[model samples]
Target: MTDSARPRRATLSDVAAAAGVSQATVSKALNGRDDVAAETREIVLAAVAELGYRPTTAPAASSRRTIAVTFDIPASPYILNVLQGVLVAATENRLDLLTRLPPDRAARGQRAVGRDWIAEQRASGAIGVVGLTLSHPDALLDAASEASLPFVMVDPVDATHKRLVSVASSNWAGARTAADYLIGLGHRRIAWIGGPEASDAARDRLYGYRAALDAAGLEIDPAHVVADQFDAAAGARHARAMLGMDLPPTAIMAADDEIAVGVLAAARELGVSVPRDLSVIGFDDTPQAPWTTPPLTTVHQHLDEMGRMAVHTVVAIADGRRPVSRHVELATSLTIRETTAPPPA
Candidate 1:
């Protein structure tokens, strides 16, 4: 064959060009530099694969298998705690953990995009995947299954598929316990500020709150129940609105510690002293829970354990072993602190 007719070999420049990044960025991504963003790295790798470009000096391949963990924006203390467990478990099991941000929601519904996303994981040497509180993961789940990759969700939100494997705390029981405790403290008018309705865990907690109120023979007040995002801002917004009412609740149950923090802020702004005029309780006893103005009283969900369990379960599935159960729920308990007391007269 004539030399002129021969195909040109792809180079690092080709990959950089394909990925719309600089050559230095491509190099940084290839070398596993921490300074490189995860999304940029993924893009570079995809470009390299598409162009069939081989690195001139490949790093020594480690024996450790990799698992990818995907999470959304605004990482919370709860997520960080779970990640700590996941990291510990991964280290103990001699596996590499890769953190990823999920693909754009707008393109998630397309079959080609979903398949490409899974293909990228495979190309990156990921044996399994763990999603932390991911929303609308149906397409990704389907793609992962088609690729024969093990997938586990840690406290998944808005998941419609029933055949998924997941690890979470006993949300309903935990919420019920918190509500029952408030009722026992002479709080007849209780309000709930919870996470989004799309979340299964959020729904379960809401149901638990309702159940506790029913058991106490209290009327279910629609105005007292609210479902919103699991953040301090949402908590603060809802708390302010409720506190301004003619008949504000004596106690409020927050979906998570962050929300509880916001509730505290709102109460302070409204000149309502906690446990004097109102009581408050929150879920996900995150580390920050104890640092509030008056330390928060919250339901403790074993966040680290949930993360560890997810890693173990996904690894087990990757090794061709069936989990004893598709869904696992860890126990939750109330951590009493200064934030809760009997309602004022």
Candidate 2:
């Protein structure tokens, strides 16, 4: 294909030729590697821009500096809160940050999408990865080890890998605190609503609730422990089902604010008044927590603090600090709102 008919792709050779430099020099300069003369590097980049060459889109590996942050799940209040912190830290460190979502299971393992995404960035000289999953990608951990790139995890991990830095909140402890607050309110026949059973957060929160109830010598009736997705509708359904039982729970502890809001809807629909008929508590005091019909009482996760900490941890690792020891766990508080009150007689 001629230049015009040649598919419009810009290659290292094309950039080198345009800048009257060697391909090796173009590669080094574009990749931000040392040894290329500063002036030569500038010329190659100028030519690259003049030709409208997008490094990331190139078939060959990138020859530009890039950084990436990824999550197993898509952007949610949880992920984005941390992502905003990652961006601030990455920018402060003068690194370009790219956020990618892992592909569905059909494309895992050999396709190991996370590693591929990071590798593509590596080919362009990306030197850091900020992972928001509670677990880190083993392949990604391996790749970073091989490349000596910085790998910062935003949450806890069961397995350890070199260059694995993490910043996390004490989900278990926070959940316990939340449960304790509800228990202190004299709520004995408390019901626990859980999220996806497989989620680390859900597991921890559930453990917290069980621990407190057990300490109180209370038997946890499995029927009262409902599992649902982290949404208001699911919470509503779970609450409705629980309420329809021969004997319903007095207070409900939802897995999240969304689920708690659903509980509110369920109460209204069932002609049960909150605080008088039912007491509700939610986790993750999202912005909407205060707007729920009765202003949901919830655990105030330090989302901003979490985000700021993740950014700090990732950036510190990128700057060559010993980051593995920096497992900072911010505390959460129970924000008393209108939704929760002493259970009625």
Candidate 3:
């Protein structure tokens, strides 16, 4: 191999390093492995193209069978439950899964950079996508569409998004059910701990709780409705303020289990007894609910079911089939537990 006859060529290692994936993953992306995610595959292919990398052996296949799952964060039981279900479904379907997060934004309301990503997915032969929270979903949808890939949204912010497929629990009905359950237990004054006021799901739940009160001919005390970020700390913060009121609510209905857990902690700190002095209800029967000091009464939002459904939808699209519905909503059921009881006399 003389210097005149030899030229430097990019190898799999170079592509892998550039794409921030392993060599094996790059190989899987190019060779049509059923285990490579679409986004990762796209990244590999783009690197391959950019670096002018050529395979020493057989070239990549024409078709790629992979599903990509994206999320805002991998923490929290609600997200974990959904992810576990997706993993199970992927195994059952014999499909590869890839998970990624949106590029970090300097601030809110600014879209994440994604035009090149969609192009890469197309070139890399990605078949489908399950989006949890893409900072710039509109761009992704367009890119995915252009690449002939199907995109499914789990717990979308807006169910009425015309161009997207979304799967979620019935938030409105679930909130209403929780409130009604508290009322059934002879609790007249109930407080609601809600997520961000800007969230549609949170708004729906707040309204549902209010609707339940309205139907029962009970006035919803505006002061009782405190906003939280659907976390334990936020729940605690809001609960303290409410619990310190001139006349506190006999029961509290939380928008989510995390918030409810925080509320429970607040109750404990303030020496409020569960079910005896105060009844509590939460939404999203996450794993935390069962382990609380007194098991929390909550609305079961079917996180696992939603995850399974999301996988099924994306897979169907990959197989050249269309989903029966663009918007799929699973039913919510009330789980009666130790935290709720008839109001104290």
State the lDDT of candidate 1 residue by residue for 200-309, as single tens digits: 99999999999999999998778889999999999999999999999999999999998999999999998999979989999999999899989999999999999999
Q: Tell me the tens digit of each residue's lDDT in model 2 across 86-164.
A: 7776676666777766445444433235444444455455556667764436666665565456666766444255445
In candidate 2, where is summed lDDT lowest over 10 consecutive residues?
56-65
lDDT, model 2, position 244: 88
Q: Give candidate 1 regions above 4 Å deviation.
A: 1-60
Write down the TM-score of every candidate. 0.83, 0.75, 0.80
Whole-model lDDT, model 2: 0.72
* Residue clash pairs of candidate 3: none
- Cα deviation at 34, candidate 2, in Å, is 21
Candidate 3 has a TM-score of 0.80
lDDT of each: 0.88, 0.72, 0.79
lDDT (C-alpha) at residue 88 in model 3: 86
Clashing pairs in 1: none
Q: How much does each candidate deviate from the true structure in C-alpha RMSD?
A: 8.2, 10.2, 9.2
Backbone steric clashes in candidate 2, count: 2
